[model samples]
Structures are given as structure tokens and as C-alpha cells.
Target chain A: MIDSRYKEMAEVGLAIRIKGLKKVYRLGQIGGTTLQEELKRRWEIWRGRDDPNTKIGQTARLTGETFMALNGINLEVRQGEALGIIGKNGAGKSTLLKILCQITAPTEGEIDINGRIASMLEVGIGFNGEMTGRENIYLSGAILGMTKAEIDRKMQDIIDFSEVEEFIDTPVKRYSSGMFVKLAFSVSAHLDSEILIMDEVLAVGDMDFQKKCLNKMREAANVQGRTVLYVSHNMNTIRRLCDRCLVLDEGKIIFDGDVDQAIALYMGIEDHLKTEYHFTEESRPYGRFSHKLSIERTVIEGVCDDPRIGQSYNNPSFGYGGYCLPKDSRQLLSNYGTIPEKIIRAVVESNDTRKKYIIDKIMRLVRMAEQAGQNSVVGIYRLSMKSGSDNSRESASLSVLRGLIDRGCTVLIYEPSLGGLCPVEGGVLVAEAEEFKSRAGIIAANRYDPCLEDVKERVFTRDFFMRD
Target chain B: MTRNTYYLDKNVHFKHISAERKWIDLRLGEVWRYRDLILLFTRRSFALTYKQTILGPIWLFLNPFLTSIMYSLVFGRIAGISTDGVPMLLFYLCSNAIWNYSSSCVTSNAHTFTSNSGLFGKVYFPRLTVPLSQVLAFVIRFSIQMSMVLVILIWYWAHGQIHPHIWALLVIPLSLVQLGLMGMGVGIIISSMTTKYRDLSILVGFGMQLWMYGTPVVYPLSQLPDGWIRSLSLLNPVTMPVELFRYAVLGTGTLQPVSLVWSWGFTLLALFLGIIVFNHVEKTFLDTV
Candidate 1:
């Protein structure tokens, strides 16, 4: 059966021939069941008892509830062809790549491949941080299926390509993130395999590196006569690199043929279904409060003016701060260079205004407590941006703490993940959780936890969402 | 057109890659082709492990030496376990060196799928290469630790404190290979099992500890009450190698013919089962793991 399939595939000059490729993944549990559960299920089946969990007419082969990641995918690729697979998240693009790489087997399929495959599904897959760049090149080369002699022959080329020759002997732990990706990509690009499979390797690094990678891939497919299977969300890169493309949706091939039409089909479906919006007065109220404030313009532009100064009590906190928003807003600002924009710039400034507003709020609370004749220690509950996380990077809580200290309030911090190790400079590290709760007159938290239930009355927060 | 034809004739080879349902597909040729990868993995592990350490490879020898000293103090003096007339240091060191090789091989290989899931999920090489490379790395470390045992043996031989057995030379190599294969087999099985049931991975550590006690590591097989317990210890694949090492060097261990056969049988069986499961798991483990 396989010999006949191979003969037919070879006659067509096909590099890859896949038929009826299906991958059904069992949800929730591993291996479908525990040993006891498996034995009991078998026993129950033997005794002619139907498992209530098993759907009627569902094949006995599917032991548990399954999701078909790739359902009956049939495709063929001509030799030296560059095939781009485009799909949204959970559309089985990665699952197809995983199967092609032979990292995971399809639930049912016959895949007749004509050449050695080198897949760069993830860059730096086995990079030891302690190993030097030179060592990592060989290790990653071997991992990508390059022989030792092959790596030795191409070592200089890889180093030159990555442009990190000076730091080749330095441990990769010391290398910048960009340098690491450069070295990883260089090794992968140097793999002398007959077929190359890649998944979004261009997503990392700068535009220059991305261009270099794309050029190298183009060389691999066009110059070297190697078959290439590329998966990416970047339609421009897809059009540039691929002659043929496959559009996948919910584990089935929705469109297959010209790259442009496939991308258009994918975009048309995605763009049309996306939630539409209009900037009317009614909808303007639903706009982010920071953007609304920027539109209101009570706070003057380019004046370091606090946007929160005259805001009504309904405005909950200044704006989102944690890890994502500030960075995203700044990135958005960078993208809008020379383009006229007001609200984009204001959203970035609103975070600073919010911190200053929080400082003012803490000062008022401290004064209120002092006037009522109580100790005025400000307890900062959780330095983490979110509850149950140790990440304090760009945390609004830390900024609030710093602001409170600048206003001359003794700050007590309660961060469980840090234990007794306080990261803040010149801040009191409260070792005991209960001691922190008892010492402070007012406790300020970015997000509320049920642990603060007893002191809920004393706690001050603008957490209206009750989520991260 | 001629050049293209020549290139196709030379490079093209059709393969039917599919979901295999068979119990075993021992692709030894594929493994052999990627022999360079095995060596590189071994080198990478060896180099990366001791890269930043000041002691470097010296720690390999120092680790077992310190472990044996502690074992001698506890088992020899404190607990008063007999080494069956062998010197306390030699017995402890011999068993420690051999046990370290076998146990580390199993422990490292058992985590083969879990620890290297990131790498395994990206590339395709013979999955056997990973556990095989781990076994080879452990062998290199074992050789270093073995040399230390040899140095102590020479010292003991010089003082006429211990007699050397010629048969030990033959038994030692055989036992070492047996121990390695046993470790590889058991490790492969655990690695495959843990890919699905992660709870098995945790149990493996505790199981190895209990397994050490069951084997004749600190105490000789002769020291155990000559009944079901002794016979049970003999049935353990690890016991044969530990006893054979002691019997070969010191010429003082309960080396029964039936037990040796049983040990060999168990090792081969475990290894056979391991390869079957490993071959089965490598194909689909990415999805489950």
C-alpha cells in the first residue's frame, strides 16, 4: 500500500504528499485516563455497559472527549515549492507544522515525504544559557539535524551571518536577546537539509534581521532547490516568499491556491466578522477614560499637567498600568511618528497623572487618620501588578509606594513571593502579613484579595473590574 | 536539465511517514546515521553542566568520593552493616561508583521527554539519541569515578589487605554493559509513561530511593537473610551488576547462577519493553506531553 503511494508521489515530482491527516487531542486529562479508570472502563465495556460519558455513535476508538486539531487534511506540494500556511489562532496551523516536523504524529494519515526535513518550529529550542555562543551554535546545529563536520564547516559563516563574532566565546546568558535570536536563526538557516519548515521565526528581532532571515529563506528555496513550508501571520512576508498558500480554518483547508487570493479570503472573513465601532457621543462615553480625558482637554498638552486633577469621582484609577498597557501605548506612539494624534499621546501621560493622583489620595487619607488621632503608616498590599504574581516590573503599586514616600509617609510592603527580600530602595520590608495589616492605618492595593476581608473597610482601591 | 536529473537521482529517496500502530519499529539505521548528534548531545550536556563551576570535571570524582565517605561512616560505623569481609571504603566506593552510573542514567533518561520537550517538539532526530546520549554522558562520569576506585584499589593491593580476582576483569565489563542497558531500558519506560501521566515522574524519584535499598548497594547479598528477601534482591536487575562488581574485585558476594540468569533475563526484558514503549511514545508524545 505504502510502496504504491510512494511510486505515485515520486512520479508527480512531489516533495510532500499528505492524505487524510487528522489529529484528535484528548482534553483535560493526560493519556485519556488513570490506570484504575482505564481498567474499570474496559471492564464496564466487556460487561456490555455503556459509558454515559461516551456519546452514542461516537467511535469506541475515541476513548475520551476529543478535539480534532486537524481533520482530514489532504495536500500535496511540488518539489522545491514554498508553501505558506495562513490561519488565525487555534486554526490548526501549528498542529499541522508539528505533524510535518514529526514532533507529533497525526491521529490518522499517510505522509509521503521525499527528502530530509529541517524544521525551525521554535528558535533556540535547546539553547543552554550557561553555554557560550560558539558551543550553542554546535548544540543548536546538532539539534536542527546538522552533522558535527557540517557545523564545523559552516561555523564561521554562521558567526559572520549573526554578526556576533566578538562575543562568540561569551556565555549566551550575557548576550542580548537580539544577539541570541541572531545566533539561533543563523544556525537554522545554515541547516543543509532538502526541506525546511518554519513557523513565525520572523516574529522576533528587528526589521533588518527579519529581512535577512527572509532573504536567507528565499535563497534556500530558490537558489538551493529546497522545499520550504512557511507559516506566518504576516501576509506581506507570505506574498514575498510563497508562490502557493493554504488557508486553514478550524482544522480544515478553507482555501488553497494562489497566495494573494488565500490571504484575501482569510482577511475578508476576519475583517468582516470583527466588531465594528463608530465614534458617536454615546460610544465616546464607552471609550477608555484616559482617551475621553484627552478629548475633553481640561488638562493642557505638553505642560506635564495632571489629567486627573479635575476628573469626577466616577473615573476609576487613572489608567491601566501593569506590564502591557504602558509598553503597548509607547509602542503605539512610536508607530505614529509625524502622524497627527492627541489621544494616543494622552493615554501614555494618563498613567503618570494617575500615580500623582494616587499620591494625593494617600496624603489625604493619612491626614484624615491623623486628624482622627491614629498612626499614619501607609501599608502597600502586594507589590505585584496582579494578585498571585511576583512580577513587580512597571507595577503601579510600586509607583504609588514611591509617591507616598516622597510625600513623607512611612510605607510598609507585603509581597508574599518576595518573602523578606524587599526590592524597593529604602522601603520597610514587612516580614509578617498580619503585622502589616495591623501596623498601617490605610492599606492601598492595586487589586483586592479576599485575604484583606477583615480590613476591607480600611482598604483603599479603585479595582472596579476585580480582575487583571 | 542534465544536472537536475543527476541531482534528483542522487538525493531523492521516498519515505512513507505515518502514524505507526505497531509495538516496535527499531529504526537503528536512522539512529546510526545520526551518531554524530549523539556525540554532540553528550558533549553539550558534559560541557554545559560544569561550564561555570570552578571545580569543573573534578566535581565528578569529588562527588562520589564524598558520597562514599558518608556511606562508609553511616553504613560501616554507625549502622554496622557488613560489607562481607571487603574493606569498608572499597565496598562502599565500588557500589557507589556502579550505582551512581546506573541510577543517574535511569533518572536522567526518565526525564528525557519532559526536560527536552522543547527540543523534541521542534526537531526530528531518533528519540533514542537523547536517552542514549544521557547514558553515554553518565558512562564518561562513571569512568572518572571508576579511576578513583582503581587508585584506592591499588593502595589496598599494595598493603596486601585485599586479593585481586582475575575473573573480575571479565565480569566487570559485562556487568557495566548490563547495568547501562538496564538503566536505559527502565529510563525509557519511565520517560514514556511520564509523558502522559506526569505523576509517574514524581513517583520515579521515590521509587529509585526505595530501589537502592532493595539492591545490594550498602549491604551485600550474602548479608541479607538467605530466603525470599535474598532471592527477591537477586531478581532485581540492579543487584546482579552491584554483586558482580563486588564479587569480581573483592571475590566476596552471593553470585548464584540462577540469579545471574534471572538478572540477565530481567535486563533484556526491561530493555525490550522500554524500546517498544519509547518507539510508540516518540511519535505521539508531543501532543500528549
Candidate 2:
């Protein structure tokens, strides 16, 4: 069967043939349905009962609402061709990539791909921080489907390309973030596969590194005759990397053909949507203070005495720092380069300023209490960035602690989540709630906890909304 | 244009590999091609198993040693469990080593799709490589522990406390393979189930502990009353290996021929079902995971 199919495909000279590809995802659950639920549904159907989830003429019945991530995507690529897939967020670009990589299956239709495919969807996958850089190189290489002998042959080249030979023996945890990306990209670039699929991996690393990656991709496609499927939000990169481009909008292919025209078509739709909103001075609700700053001030006013006293003022604790915000903000800043912008730069620096402001307020309160002849020990309520979470990475409380220490203030931390040990030096970790209350002259909290209601008079916080 | 025309003129044969909606596409050939990846994952997990610890690989032996000591104290001294005249240490150690290998394989494979979702999300290597590597890692650890068992068996043999059957050489390897398949099969099924309903993943820990009791790991199969209880224990696939391992090494065990055949049959069926579920889940697990 495969031989006959291959013979038919060979006549067409197509490197990849995808027909009527569709991927429908159930909103909440995995694997579509459970055995019990499926049996129940089947029983109901057998009894001639109407099933709410079934549509007429559709063979598959969904238990819940479903989103068609890729709807009838039909496309083909010739051998050694460079194809770019562009879409807005949720336009099914990632779903398409996942299908091509076979990481996830398409709910319907079929994709026939010729040649070995090496996908770098998110770089630095399978990197262990405890392992040395050299070991991680081999590990990541193998994960990308390179054999041990293949990695051995390219080890020197990978090390040289990443420029981490001096520190290759050091644990990856010790390598700088940039060096880590360099090593990861190097390993993937060295994969000798016939088809390469890359998705926004170049969005990381420095400009020079990105240029090098683009050049390597060019060499892989143009010089060595390899098919390339590139996905990126950057139109410039898309144009540079691909000869033909596909524009996807809401799971459907809107346009497919010349790279420039596809990009133009995408941009045209985006521009049309964007033109509806005008950010002129006349549109500013709060005169000169930009809408962002005004909103920040208003939120601060609701929570604190003044906007200058809290971290973000807008959100009580620092600005958003969950998985996406910090990295995306940095990426946005990098795209702006040296452009003289106030709000953009302030968004990055506001967290630090807020941390400093918190420190200043705590110090002032401590000094006032000391002058009034009270023991000026400041108690830190929690170390986590948000309530009911143990993750302290980029937590505003840590920054506050650092600021308090740098200014030489006596501080005690009360965090049950951190267990018995105090993470910071010079600050005792109070295990008991009563002991913490008695020792603290003033308490600092990112968000208000009801456990401190009895000591509310001594507590200092800017949590108005009381939400994460 | 010239390249396209030349390819058409040459009638170059192309391989069209399409994704199908079949319930049981084993894709065993694809798994075989990615054997190197499986090996690397095995090595990576082995290295990481004790990366940060000061004792390192020594802990591999220490684990079974400590477990056996605890069992000897509890079951031998306190509970007065019979070892059938074979040394209690050797009995527990042998059974524990085999039991640990099988249990670990199932428990670890149960999280195959959930735990490796990060790695699985980005690339395409045969999804089987992950569970296969996990099973291989268990085998490596089992081998290391087996050496310790061998030393104990030899010491007991020297003292004339036990007489191991010469057939042990064949039984040992055969039972290990049986245990590995049983574990892998159960694990893959659980792992596939866990992708959608996480209740199974949570239940696996308690379920494994209960499963250990159901198997004749601590007690000899002969000790059970010859009725429903014995018949039930005989039906358990794990009971065959425990009994077989004890029969091979200690030369005194209740080996029911019918039960042995049932165990092998169950292993094949479970493994077949596991592959089908795993293949079906691997295709679209990301949607839920």
C-alpha cells in the first residue's frame, strides 16, 4: 500500500502533501472522551435518544464545545522549497506545527510528509540544568533524533558554533541564559535532516545570533537542498526565510502564494482592524498622563494612600510576572531598540521603582516606630508573588526584602510555605503566628491575608482588589 | 521549474506516509529506527536518577538493601511470615528485587504522556521511546540489584541453607522479561487513561501498593488456602513471576502450570491493549494535557 502511494506521490514530485487537515479540540478534557462516558453516550444513542453533542451527518460526537483549530487546511510543498506559515494568535499556526511534528494528531484528514523532519518548535527542550553543557548537547541532540555517532562527529562544530567551549564542562545551570540558547540552537542547527521545521526559536537570542540562524537556515535550504517550514510573527524574517508563504486566519488558509503578497494580505487585515482605534492626545481621558499611567494611578489611589508608595500601584504587587509577561515584555522592548519611548521603558523599570518605594515606606514606618520607643522589627507576611502559591521567582516580596536588607533594617519573615528556614540572611523566620505578631513593629504584605486581621492596625499593604 | 520537470521525467519514487485514524497503528518500525534516541534517554535518566546525591549510584543497591532489612525486621521477626526454610533475607531480597522492577516500570510508565508532555510537545521521535527508555532504566537498576541477590544466593548455597534449581538460569531471565512486559502494558494503559481523566494517575500510587499485597511477594503461594483465595492469587500475572523466581532460586515454590500460562496470556493481551491505547492517545493528547 505504501509503495503504491509513494509511486503516486513521486509522479507529482511533492515533498509534503496535506489534504483536508482538520483538528477539533474539546474545550476542557484530553483524549476526547472517557470509556464510561462513551459507553453511556452509545447506550443513549442505541435507545434512540437525541444526543445534544451530536450534529447531523457527523460521525463523531463531542461531549463538550469544541474548537476547530485547523479546519480543512490543504497545502503541498515541492522538494527543497521554503514555506512560511503566518497567522495571528489562535489562527492555528501552532496547531499546524504540532500536526506536522506529529506531537499532536489531526482530528480529521491526513498529512503525508516525505523525508525525515527535525522540528525546533521551542528550543532548549529536554535540557537538564544539573547536567553539564556537553552532556546537554548530546541529550538535546539525541532528542532531535541525531544518533550518538552523529553527535560525536558534530560535537566540536556545535561547541565552536555556540562559543561555549570554555564552559562546556560546567553544569548548564551555571551557563548564562544567552549561552544556553546558543548551545540549544547550535545542536538543532547541526541536525542533518531533509526537512526542518522551526517556530519562533529565532525570536530568542541576540540579533547577531538570529542573523547567524537565518544564514544557517538559508544554507540548509539553498545550499544543501532541504525543505523548510518556518513560522514567525516577524514578517521581515518570514519574507527573508521563505519563498512562498501561507496566511492562516481563524484556522482557515486565507491566502497562499508569493511571500510578499501573503504578508501584505495579512498586514492589510491587521491594519484595517487596528485603524478603528486612534491613540491621539485628544482621545486621552486623563489629559497628559497617558491612559496606562492614569489607570495605574487610579488603581493605586483605590488601594494605597499614594501611587508612589506601591510596587506597580496598578496591581498592588509588581506588574505581571507569570510565565508570559516578563519574557514578552523583554521581547517587545528588544523590538523597539533605541527608540525614545517613555511608557514602554517605564513598564520595564516600574517594578524596580515600586520595590524601592515599598522599601522606603517600610523604612520610614520603622524609623517612626523607633523614635516612638517601639521595637522596629518589620515582619514580611509572605514570599510568594501571589497568594496560595509557593513560586517566588521574580516575587515582589523578594525585591522588597533585598531593598530592606540593603538599607540595613531589622526584618523577620513569616512564611509557612517556605517551611522553617529563612531564605534571606539577617532575617529570622518566625514559625509561630503569635511570635511574629509580638516581634513585628510593622508588617509588610503584598496582598492582605485575613490571618493578620487582628494585627491589621500594624499591617501595611496595597491590596484593594484582593485577587491575583 | 527545471527541477520539477527533471523529477517528473525521472519518475522518482517518493514515500507517502499519511496519518490515519486507525485505533492500533503500532508503528514498530518507526520505533526501531529511533532506537538510538531510546538508548540516549535511558542513559540520560540513569545519570539523572542520582545526579545530585552524594552517594550517587551506590543508592541503587542501598535502596533494596534497606528495603530487605526493613522487611526482615517487620515480616520475619514481628509478623512471623514463613520463608519456607530459605533464609528470610534472601527470600525477601529476591522477591523485592523482582517486584520493585515490575512495579517501578508500571508506576513510571503511568506518567509517560503527562510527565514528558514538555518534550513531546516540541518534537517527533517515536512516542514509544519514552516508555521504552523508562523500562530499560528499570532493567538496568534491576540488574544491579540482581548482582546483590546473586551474592546472597551464593552465600546461602555455601552454607547449605538453600539449593537453587539449575533451571534458575533460564527462569530468571524469562521471569524478568515477563515482569517487564506486564509492567509496561499496565503502565501504558494507565498513562493513556491519565491523559484524559487524572483520577487514575492519583489512584496509581495506592493501587500499586494494593497490587503488591495481592501478589505473592512476601508469602509463598503454597501458604494460601487452596480455594478462592489461591485461585484469585493464581490469576494475578505478578504471582507467576514471584512464584517462578522463588521456585528457581529456593527450589521450593507453588508453581501452577495453568496459572503460568494464564499469566503469559494476560501479559500479551494487556501489552496489545496498551499499544493501541498509547497510539490513540499519543496522536492528540496535547489537546487535553
Candidate 3:
């Protein structure tokens, strides 16, 4: 009857029909504090105060943002259809399956399902550890919403299928992770649900198990006439299991039609002629907990292998110079207390620095650069901490200035920090930040701040996110 | 599409679970649906306990016997606590077996979230069933242990070392109710709390150890020196079952009928609250845990 309905819909040009699908996760950990917050919010709503922040997307900048993982995705599925979803992680493939399974409630969405849904999200999820393999069978059955009697009927078959008959008496805790995963997977597959939602569950138990899982999926889809939504990182699984595809990038569907085309799109096989680096900070979005910042106009010079003007890392002469910000300066300071200024500067130096711990020893790099023999003036740039507006740094720009001065080359101050506190004792003041770039052969920055965007060729610094 | 093998009777009100009359009927239906799996779990629980042991199931009887002897000597002789004129060894063994059944269930149930987190993360099921099966398995073990106590009691009765009361007939159903209610109630409560703070799981082990002293397992209520100690001993829910058990079996102590009734009321209340909290906690436990 369901199949006939699907066929009828296809005859009238409807494959899958979805309307106004939305999912929202209320952020913040559920704890005692959350309980208090819930009470407060409920009391406010009861009193008709509106809480001021009750509106959707209104509390975006608070402790947690209300993220719309999926936004109004409407689609139709015909009698026989396979769809593949591709995205660079966090594109909401897993979320869609979870919603279908009703494992979690969507903040807003309506799903009309015509069949039972089975999910192979992970193995050993419905298992009882204290119970032996035999006892867990009953527990697992109840977990799958099957009656105890139903479990009794299926007991022999499940044991044989799992190939864990010998170890059935042993508690699951003693089982190796691999054996446990296999048995759990076997149980899930045996469950006779019509609609299957699998989320990267195949990447377990070794190569044999993986192949078996794929075969099982094929059997469920092709032989059983069951509809399946499978999510995986393996492109080959997508190519094999899926008939059509939907590509999701940054939480939005980028392409949806052909599986082959979707795979190609996912792999970045398409051609684009723009020579400039096409990057958007929002493009590489990680989860809410991780920081995502953008840095532009990084320049590295002074080394013999420095790149030609406007060249990328691919160029032969442009030896890729990447630097790490000293991650825990506070901890390092706490460990050593306050060391001499020279020692602190050397310890926190990024790769571009040529400094020795003691003043008696001269660095080979400085000697080499001096031997190159030009009236080379090195420009010193901004030195600051990680983010926000703060500048209590053991400044590396000062190191470059000092190093250049020690080597008998002209040094310049481009920083206002110098003017306010320790004004350049010996170096010339190139008053204009822009003018300093043209005058100096090398511009060394403690951080790749955005202000030096034009003279990117002469800039040498490591600032992955410009805010730092 | 294959012809449907599964069938639901129209007369069966599948959604009406609130009616106590229908509870067993609906549960039976679900039990029939999952019969094969429950058998699997029950068998698994039994077999796994004895899996790798050299003596295997023999340890089940030996565990309670050894514990009983230790408690009897420590509490019966040195402390001079009367076990209601019953053989101290037999009395402690009977009470210890029941307490073990209930306490094990509670401790295991407390760590339900932390221990089964891996499984819960992956699968869909009525999470209660895992703990339920554990309680059942513990019940089975308790049955075996009780048999040992029965054999010792019959021997002592024949030799005239102990007297048996007609109230002892009530012990069977009373023991079942006493153990089950306490286990289910305490188990659910601990399971709910342990999800958020693992401190409860750690505390349960030590708490159970100290709790034995408060119950009449090692000492009779009459052994209390005075008012506060006697009153405090009565407050422990376990005191009722132990005292009732001693009275029914040995017929040597005053059976405070009112206190016993109060204990029953408390046990039921605890069980009721436990179920409610467990149901609520199970819904959103995954998000927090």
C-alpha cells in the first residue's frame, strides 16, 4: 500500500515532499544552574514578560548562540530513490538522521514517516554490560522497543548471527572492543525496521566487518525495498550505496541531483579561474567551542629563500614560513617567574628571529644577513597578545630591531608602543607606517596585523588570525 | 513487500498504559514481542557471572556463607548482640543475602549512566530494561542464596535451636516486597543522580557498608543500649524487614507491628518517587551525561 502511494506520487511528479523543516538546539549544559534558568524563564513567560531574549536569533551574542543546523529543507522521495549528502563536516547529515529516528526532537520540524526506522549510528549503544551476552539479548530487545517474548523468539537466530555463541555467558565488559562492536552491529542489522538511518557506523571492527556492513546495507536497500539514509566519510560508500546525491556545504545544500556530480563537487574537482586566494572565515566553520578567525597579508622575507613578489607557498623561492604564537605565555612566565628581558624575548621568539640567550654569542643568521651587504633597514611591526585589545607582550618586534642594530644595519620603529614607553634608543623613527615599508628592505612583524596589507611582500610574521 | 508477519489486535489499547489493570496486559504484549531477547538477557546474566571462575556458580552460595560467618562472629560474640535467640550464623546469612541483592542493584543502577554510556550513545531502546535485567539477575542470585538459608533454618528447627512462628509464612511475599521495593527505589534514585555527578556512585559503596550497621543485620533492635540508639535503628527502612524476619523465624523478639507498617509505607513511597525521577532522568540523560 505504501509502495503504491509512492508510485502514485511519482506518476504525479512527486518524489519526496517536505515542508518548513527546522531544527534548533538549546545551548548550555543541563545542570543545577540550567534548572534555575528554566524556572526563571518559565516564571517570566507565565507573567507575560517575554524575557526580552525570547525571540529567535535574538540571544545570538550571549553565552551560547541558537544555531539553525538545518533550515526549512523540503524534498520528495519517489518509490525507489537513493540520495547521498556531502559536506565538509558539520553540514547536518547526522542531525537529519537523528531527527528521522526521533532520537532527539527538532526545535521545529514535521516528519511524516510511513515505515519503521532503524539506525546504525554506533555499535554497542543498546547493550547491557553487567548482563552476559545471553541476558543482554533480552535487554537489547526491550531497548529496540520489542517485547520480551519477541526477543525470546529471536534469541537463537541473534546468537547464531552474532557468532558470539561461545562467549554468550560472559559479561560484555570482558569482551574485546572489536567483538562487542561486531555483536552489537549484528543485532542492529537483524532488527526489521523499514527505514534505516546509518551515521558513519561502518568505520569499526576492521576491514572484514566494514565490508559486511556495506553488504548488509545493500541487502536492506535492494532486497528489502527499504528506504535508507546513510552518512559516511568514505566517498566510495556514497558512490556504491547512493543513486542520487545532495551536497551540503556550510549547512546549506550546494548541489542536489547526480551522485557523480555531487562527489565531484565534494572533492573540489570543479574549475575556478580566480588567482587570488578565495577564503572566507565563515567557510571553515568548526563547532561553537572552537575559535574561527581570519588572517590576511602575511609576508616573510630576509631569508635567502624568501619568495618573489606576490608569490604563494607553491613558488620555489617562497619557502613556506609558518609560525606559532607562543601558546601559554602566562604559564611559561609562571613557571620561570620573570626572566631577564633578553631571555624572555629569546624564549618566546617565533621562527623568524635570530637571537642568542647570552649577548656574547652572535647568531649566524644575523651575520649572514649582514654579509649580504646592503644599507638594509629592517622594519619592526606590532607586538601584542592573542586577541581583543591588549598589548602586554614580551615584544618580538623589539628583538628584530635589536638584532638589526647589533649587526650594524639601520633599524626603524613603526610601533606606537615604542613611542609611549621605550622609544627607540638608537633606531630611526619612520613616522608613517606606510613610508617605513618602502624605506626598509625587510619589514619584520611580531604579528601579521591587517594594516600591512599593501607591503605584504616585505612583511615577515606569523599571525594566523589577525585579531591576535 | 512481504506479507506482514506482525499483527496487533484491535482490542488491545496499545497507548493506554496508565490503567493499572491494563499494565500487565500491555507489558505482556511487549514481552511477547521481545520474548526472544529477554530470554537472551536472562541467560546472559546467569552465565556471565560464572563465566571465567574456576568454581563458577559455587561461589554464589559461598559468597553469602563466608560473609554471614564474618558478620556473626564480629557482631554476635564480641559485640554480644542478640540475634533474637536464632543461630547468629543463620540469621546474619539470611539478612545479608537479601541486603546484598538490594544493595548490588542500587550500586549497579547508580552507575547506569557512566557504565552504559557507550551503549546508550549508539542504540535506541527503553534504557530501563538494562537495569531491570540486572535487578532480575540479582534476584535470581538472591533466590539461590535464600535456599541455603532455608536449609540451615530447617536443620536448626529440627534440633530445637530456633522456634518458628506462623508469621514466618508471611516471610516469602514479605521478603520479595521488601527487597524489590528497596532495590527499585534506591536503584532509580542513584541512577538518576549519578548521571550528573559521579560522586553519588562513589558514595553509594561506602554508604552501603555503613548502612549495614544501622539495619538489624548484625544486631537486634533490643541490643540498643537506650532511647536514641533504639529510635535511630528503627528509622532505617531495612530495620523493619530484618526484625520481621527474625520475629517470623525465631519468634523471640517483640515485633513492632506499627513500625513494620510504617516501613512498608516508606518503601512504597520511595519506589513511587524513584520511578518518577527515573522516567524524567532517562528522557534527557544523554544530553547531560
TM-score of each: 0.72, 0.71, 0.60
Model 2: per-residue lDDT, tens digit, B1-289? 0000012223342333345555656777668867888888899899888988999999988989899989999988899998888899888998898889999999999999989988888887778898888888898899998898898889889999998888676878888888888899999999998887777888999999999999988888887888999999999988988888888888878888899999999999988999888887887777777
Docking band of candidate 2: acceptable
Candidate 3 C-alpha lDDT tens digits along A1-468: 444544454465432344455665546433333334556666876897754335465552442555677776665654345566666556777766665554544445444454455667766655767667776666665566556666677888888767778998988888877778777777777776666677766655644566777787788778877666777655656777888788776546778888877765665422221222211122122232222212222222112222343344245563222322221221121112111111101111122222333111223332333344332322222322222222222243444444444555333222223222122222232332233333322223321222333433222211101101
Instruction: Write candidate 2's Cα lDDT for A1-468 as tens digits.
Output: 555555666577677888898888775433325555655666777899855345566544444568999899899888788899887779999889888877777767776666677889988988999889998998899888888899999999999988889999999999887788899899999998778899877654654676788889988888998999998876656777899999999999999999978866765453311111111111233332211110010000111233233233345453332212132222222222211111100111122234565456555544543454333322222333332233333345556555655676534333212321232222332222223333222223222222333332222211101101
| Model 1 lDDT per residue over B118-172, tens place | 7787887788998889888988888888888899898988888777777677877
Once superposed on the true structure, which residue ranges of model 3 sit more than 4 Å away at CA?
A1-83, A110-112, A124-185, A202-215, A248-258, A268-468, B1-39, B224-235, B252-254
Q: What is candidate 3's lDDT per residue for B212-241, written digit by digit as tens?
A: 778776677777777888877777777777
Better of 1 and 2 by DockQ: 1
Chain B TM-score per candidate, please: 0.93, 0.93, 0.83
Model 1 ranges off by over 4 Å? A1-7, A28-63, A273-468, B1-10
Candidate 1 positional error at A290, Å:
18
- Looking at model 1, residue A249 earns an lDDT score of 94
What value does the lDDT take at residue A189 in candidate 1?
A: 86
